[model samples]
Every structure is written in C-alpha cells, then in structure tokens.
Target: MEHSFHYLLLANQATVHRQLLAKLKDTGLTLGQPKVLDYLQDHDGANQAEIARACHIEPASLTSVLNRMEVKALVERRTQKGDRRSFAVYLTGQGHSMALRVRQAFEELEEQAFAGVSEAEREQFLAVFRRVYGNLKEGER
Candidate 1:
C-alpha cells in the first residue's frame, strides 16, 4: 500500500498518543482521560452533556470515563438543582493536582515530538495543519 499524507498524519498522531499515554501511566490516566481533565480544568462544574460536547465524546462514553475518573478520586459528580437526571462535574483536589501534571507531561511530550525541528519549519507545518483542519471541518455545523 502506498503511504500518503493522511497515513503520515495518522501515524504521527498514534505515536504521539502512545508517548503521552506512557507518561500518563504513572498517574493512572489513560489516553482520552487527559483531554477530559484538561477541559474540566478550565470549565469546572460543567454538566455531563456539556463536557461530552466539549470533549467531542459521546455522552455514553463520557459517562464511562467519568465513572472511572470518579473511582480514581479524580472527579466528583453532583446532582444538578432542579434536574434530578443531570449532574455537574468537578475536579477533586487530587484531580486538580493531576491536571497540572497532565499539562506538564503533554508539554514535555510535545517538545520531544518536535525536537530538532526548526522554528520556521514548525510554523509552516502548523500553518498547513490549520488549513487542513479547516478543510476537514468545512461541513461541520
């Protein structure tokens, strides 16, 4: 099979994700969990639906992830006022501390991924990536 830009893109993404996951293993965080923690770091107390949308995950999948996070003592879910079926999510103290570590780990991983790439080349790659991302999202509502 001939490799194309899409192949390279996905391959790179997989490599980066693998590296981040390895680093996060010590903290007991999985691949997608960091994205949720990062979102809640800024938007603490968001409801599950809001978090699902923000995290680009299905509500059912988010429910599972939140359950795991809760078990890990990283987050808490509270019943929302006037809505028994709804709950607001908040990061626990431990969650907040782990979020900081997650952020640092991601920074280090990113640096490692881009090591030895010149600033100009990095900027050019980013510009191209933005255009590609926009193109892919053109039909998104």
Candidate 2:
C-alpha cells in the first residue's frame, strides 16, 4: 500500500527493465552483455579493464560474460602487444552483426516506451528523474 512517488518510480523502473530483458532475450543476450557489446562497438579493441569500467561492470562479472561471449565466438581476447599478461577485447564478425541488433533493440524499446508521450514531457520527466537520482546519490559520497 505504498503511495509514495518513490514507490511508483521504482515500480515503473522494474517494469521497464523486465520488458527490456525480454526484448534482449530474443537476441541471446542478457541485460549486461549488450551494454558491453554496445560500448565496444564504439571503442573496439579496448582492454578488459577499460571495457569493464565503461560498461559499469565489475572485472569478475565482465570476465564471466566475456567467457560466455568467447564460447559463442562473438568476441575474442588477444594478448596486448608488449604486455603478454594483459588482453585486448575485439568483436568478431558475428559480434558486430549482433551489436547492430542490440542497438536496434534499445532504440525500439525507447520508441515503444515513449509512444504517445510528447518530447517536452519526456525531457521534463528525465530532468526530474535526474534530480531525484542525484538527491539519493548525495548520501553515498
């Protein structure tokens, strides 16, 4: 029976994420994997650590995802030149194609989610959301 705006906002967020997961599932990717691929699409051949940071994922989690992606032949990790201990990640041809799909999936989701909502309303909502997020994050730092 929570009537607070926070409850409504959280509920909406959960629903949207669930729908996004469903959409991405069709492409054989989990929630986080597409983000990694999307980032790498723009910054190909990035190191594992860089990719993890850019994708807002932990190194261990990125390692697990990369392992799965490697098995799928979507990405390959090669030893960095002059740094045999470090690896650079590169997308295979399959991965490049999948990345395109991932981008399209995200665009479709956004379009569907915002259907019938005017641009001004969307901008105002985003402004408010960012303020709320900042307020909550203030305590963490």
Candidate 3:
C-alpha cells in the first residue's frame, strides 16, 4: 500500500495543495477564491448558480465566498435585468487584474508539476488518468 499508485496519488495531491496555498499567499487569496477567479476570467457577469456549477462549489458556500470577495472589492453582484432576487456577478477592476495573476500562478504550477516529463509521456499519463477517473465516476452512479 505504501508504494501503490492510489497512495502515491493522494500524497501528490496533498503536496499540490500545499504548493497552491503557498502560491496564493501573496495574492491574499484562498482556495475557493481561485476557482471563482478562474471561472470569472471568461464568464464575467455570470449568475451565482452558474458560477457555482462551473466551479464545482455548492451554492450556499459560493454565497459566502462571493460575500468575502465583495468585501475585498474583487467582485460585485448587480441585480440582473427582470430578476429582482437574482444577481449577475461581475469582476471589479481589481478582480480582473487578480484573475490574470491567478491564471499565471496556475500556469506556473502546471509547468512545475510536469517540469521533467516529455510531452508524449505527459499526454499518455493524462489519458490513463482520465480513463481511471471516468471509471470511478461511473462506479459512483
């Protein structure tokens, strides 16, 4: 079990999580924030539900995240036309700039993660990983 792929994968995931936290420290961002920033990079003006679905975040949790972001002046929720209770979220100027930094940070991490691998090896590994993920997803249903 110590040397199993599943065990090693979990360890790698933890390492990546730590690395992400370290990278995000400078931006004054946290885990859920980056997901939202990445989502809003191209989908500015998205509604709460849309952002939640895209970011794989629960609606209730997303509300809190958005509320915190609003406090940071990273996003603003405006009333959607014809919808009094629903709002469309837009990145503030600061959020737009932060989004770019988030993208850069993710790119750098990806590059670092695969620093030594050949393109062919990376492609093959990802293909197998996808297949394994699909199998697990199917088993859940």
Best by lDDT: 3
Give Cα distance to truth, residue 110, candidate 3, Å.
Answer: 0.6
lDDT of 3 by residue, 56-102 (tens): 89999999999999999999999999788999999999999999988
lDDT of 1: 0.89
Put down candidate 1 lDDT per residue, 26-132, tens digits, no spaces: 88787578989989999999999999988889999999999999999999999889788989999999999998888888789878877999999989989999999
Better by TM-score, candidate 3 or 1: 1
Q: Quote the lDDT for 79 in model 2.
A: 93
Please give the clash total of every predicted structure, in order. Answer: 0, 0, 0
Query: Per-residue lDDT of 87-140 in model 2, one digit per residue for the tens?
Result: 999999999998888888778888887899999999998899899878987977
Per TM-score, the best of the predicted structures is 1
Which ranges in model 2 have alpha carbons more than 4 Å from their true place?
Answer: 1-10, 130-139
Any residue pairs clashing in model 3, and if so which? Answer: none
Worst-scoring 10-residue span by lDDT in model 2: 23-32
Q: TM-score per candidate, in order?
A: 0.86, 0.79, 0.86
What is the alpha-carbon lDDT for the whole of candidate 3? 0.91
Which candidate, 2 or 3, would have the higher TM-score against the true structure? 3
